[model samples]
Target chain A: MKWKEKDAAMYLAEKEYVDTAVIPLMPVTAGKDMQDVVKSGEFIRYFTEYLERQYAGRVYLFPAFTYIKTKQVPEEQLKHWQELLREEGFNHFLFITSDASWRRTSADSFGELFWIPAFSVENMEVQELAKTMEQQVQQLVPLMMDMWQSEEK
Target chain B: MSEKNHRVSRRQFLTYTLTGVGGFMAAGMLAPMVRMALDPALEASGGAEFVSVGLSEDDLSEEPQRVDFNVEIVDGWYTSEQSRSAWVFLYEGEILALSPTCTHLGCTVNFGTNEEYPDQFFCPCHFGRFERDGTNIPGTPPTRPLDVYDVEVRDGMIYLGQINQRG
Candidate 1:
C-alpha cells in the first residue's frame, strides 16, 4: 500500500495486517546545477515503488521525506516520525535513499537507514536501468528479511 | 364532415398522454437496476483471461522456477498493468504455477530458502512456511494453502489464468 487516498483507505481497514512502513528519504538541492541530486530523487522513487510492489499487502510505502541537501540531516524530525509511525501501529520502519550523507547520522534515533550510492540515470539505456534497479532490490531483500525475522523473535 | 372524426375527448387525451409519459419514466428508473442484475452474465468469464508467462514447456523442471509476467488489471474505472510473480514447476506430469504470496499476511515467499526445511516454501515475515505442494505447515501462521494459478499450455507456451485457492 502507498500513501495515496485509495491505498490508505484499504490500509486503515486492514491496519493489523500491514505492519511495515517504508519511507523514501529524498534530498532536494535548490540550484539548477544539481542535476545529480534530482536524479537521485527519481532513483529513490523507483526503488521504493519496487519494494512496495514486492511486499504490497504487508508494507505501507509512505510519501518521501524531502529535505534540503546542504543542511544537516534532520535527526529531530526523523525521531518524531519514528514515534508517530510507532503510535500508528507500524512495528517495522525501513528508510531507503541514495543519499550518502545519512551514513554520518546516528541510526539509533530512527529506523534502519539504507544509504545506497547515488548513480546518474540520465542517458542510460532501458535494459541497463532495469538491471541497476534489480541489483538494488536484491541487496535490500535480505536486509528486509533479517529485519522481519528479528521482529519475530 | 362528421364532428366526431377529428375531435378527441379531454379525458381520453389526458389518459393517453399520461400513460406514455409514465411508461418512459418507469423504464428510465429501471434501466440501471436491470443492467446491474444482468452484469455478471455480460462480463467475460474468469477463464477467458490468460496472461502469457513467457515460459515454454521446456523451461519447467522438477524444481520451482520463479516467473514474472505483467497482466492488465481493471479495478472499477481504473485500468493498469501489474507485474505478478509465480513459482512454476512440473509435478507428476502436470504444470503447476503457485503464487509466491504467502497465505499468511501476504508476504512474498521464497522456495527452498530455509536450510532446515530445504524443500518447503518459507516466508521471511513471521517465519511462516509451506510444504512443497503449497500446503501450510502444521501450526504455522497460515491456515490455508498457497494459491495456485490456472495453467494452460498453448503452442508450447505456458499461459496462466486466475489464482485459485486450493481445497
Candidate 2:
C-alpha cells in the first residue's frame, strides 16, 4: 500500500489496498518569511493535501511519518547524533515523528542559509527543504526495506 | 362570472397560497432529517455490514488455531483483528471460545505448560491455574472461570459478542 500527504485517518484503508506506492511529497516552505522557522504546520498541511489529491484512487494515503528539525544540522553532524540509533537498532524503519522546529535538508555545510540556522541572520526557503527531502527518501528506503524483511524472518 | 362564488378575497387567496407553499417547504426541510435519523438503523440490519466467520458450531480440536477475520467498520475504514494464537479443544461438537484472560488477576494465561502441570492454563500472576474445562483449581488464586464469548450462528457463520463468564 502507498501513503501520500492526503488524510491522517486514511491509514486504515490504505493498509488494505494492495497495489499502491506511498508518495511523500517533496517538502516546500510556505513563504520566504524569516520571522520563524518556516512554519512546519503550513508546510505539512499542504504537503498532506498534495499526497491525497495526487494519489486518491491509485493508492491509500497514510499519515505523514514526519521528522522536523529546528536547525539544519549538516548530514555529517546528524550522523553523529543518531549514531546510537543504528548501534542499538532503533531504526525500525517504521513511520517516525520529530518535534524539531526546523525543516530537513542534506547540506554538508550548514552555513547561515543551511536552515533556520543557529543564531544568525538567515531564513530557510522551500528549495532547500525540498532538496533535503529528496535525498532523505532515497537514502532511507533501502534501510527501511531491510528492517521490514528482518521482522518477517 | 358563474364561478364567482368559488373565488375568495385577495387576502384570503394570498394566505391560502402562502400556506400551501409553507407546507411544501416544511416537508422538504424535514425529509432530510427523517432520512438521517433512520439511515443508521437500516445499515445496521443490512447483512453486508459485518460478515461473521463460522466458528460456533464447529467441533473444537485439541490444537492451537489462528482464526483470521475482517470487518468493514466505517464507510472508509476496514478494521481487522486476528487471533495470533487461539487454543481449541473439543466439547461434544460445541466449539468454545477459550480466551487467554487469566482468572486470578486478568493477566494473560499461558498455554505453554511445565512438567508439573501437564494440561492446564498457567497464569503467571499469583500462580493461578485452571483446568482444561476452565475450572479454577482449588488453592489457586483464581476464584472464577474464564470468560466465554457469546456465540451466534447466522447462515453457517459465527458472530461473537461480549465474553460472558461461566457462573
Candidate 3:
C-alpha cells in the first residue's frame, strides 16, 4: 500500500498531472453488524479533516468518496480485510478482488474474489476518463499544494 | 410640527410610550427566533455525504499503486458533477484510500507497468510523489506519498470520506 501511494504520486508528478481523489464507491462494507455505515461516515470525516489540515488547503476530499453505495464483497472477505489491515497497511481505501484469497465465508458460502477495482478505466475508457481527471487536477493542484514553504521528504 | 404633529396630544403621548415598550418586547421575543431560522443555513454550508470507493477486500493487492472511484456530486440548488478519482496504496485485505492528485503540478499520475519491474505510478506533471502518503520507493519522481483517506465499514457496506492529503 505504501509503495502504491508513492508510486501513484510519482506518476502524477512526472506527468505533471493532478486529478480528483475519489473515495471509491462502497459495494461491500467491513463491519460486525449489518448497519454500521454511520461509523463509516465518521471515519471518512476524520480523514477529510486530516487531509485538509495536513495539506493546509491545497486539496479537498471530494464528497462522493464518503458515500456508502453498495454491498458487493462477501462477508468472509471483509473479515480478511480487517485482519489484513493489521498485517498489511492500506492507508484507508476498501479493496477486494477474486485474486486476494481469503479463508472465511459469507452466508454459508465460500467463494473466491471476482474483482479488485483500482484501475481507472485506464483501459475501460481512457480518453473520457483522462479528460475528467485532468480537469480535477487543474482545479485541485493549486488547492492541494499550498505547502510551498515546507521542506520535502 | 404640522397637523399630524399637533395631534400628538395626551393620549398620543401614552401610545408612544407603550409603543416603545412593545418594540422592546418584540425584539426580546425575536432574537432566538432569528437564530433558529439561520442555524440550518449555517450548518448546510459544511458538507454532505462521504466518498465510498467500491473495492472488495480480496482484490486489494500487496503491491502499492493507484486506485480510482467514480460518483455523482450535488451542489447547492440544481448543480451537480460526476466525479472520477484515483488514490495510491498497497492492499492486504485492508482498505487504504490515497489521493492521486500530485500536490505540485496538475496532472493525473499514469500507472506504468512492465513485465520486468513491478508496476509503478508515474506522474507526467513535474515528478512529485509523497504529495499524499502511503508507501515510498527509491528513485521515484513523486516526493510525497499519495494522500490517505479515512475508511469505515457499516452494515456490510463501505463508506469513504475526505481525501487524506498528508497521510
Best candidate, DockQ = 1
Q: Which ranges in model 2 have alpha carbons more than 4 Å from their true place?
A: A1-153, B5-17, B27-59, B62-93, B110-119, B124-126, B165-167
Q: What level of docking quality does candidate 1 show? A: acceptable
For model 3 the local lDDT of residue B13 reads 86
**All candidates' TM-scores?**
0.75, 0.37, 0.36
- Candidate 1 per-residue lDDT over residues A58-140, each given as its tens digit: 89998998888865888778878888999999988888988777788875346878888766777755445555676888998
Q: What is the per-residue lDDT of model 2 for residues A82-142, given as tens digits with 9 covering 90 to 100? A: 4433353332212222223223443222211111111211343433433344343344334
Please list all clashing residue pairs in model 1, or write none if there are none.
Answer: none
For residues B1-167, could you state the per-residue lDDT of candidate 2 as single tens digits? Answer: 55567668778999999999999999999999999999888674434433354465454476533243443334446553322223445555676656566654344565545458867777642457877767788998778887665555676556654456785
Q: What are the DockQ scores of the candidates, in order?
A: 0.30, 0.02, 0.03
- Alpha carbon deviation, residue B133, candidate 3 (Å): 6.0
Q: Which stretches in model 3 have alpha-carbon errors above 4 Å?
A: A1-153, B1-48, B63-68, B71-78, B88-93, B111-119, B125-141
- Model with the higher TM-score, candidate 2 or 3: 2
**After superposing the true interface residues, what Cα RMSD does each candidate give?**
3.7, 21.4, 9.5
Highest TM-score model number: 1
Candidate 2 similarity to native, TM-score? 0.37
Please give the range of 10 consecutive residues that has the lowest summed lDDT in model 1 chain A: A124-133
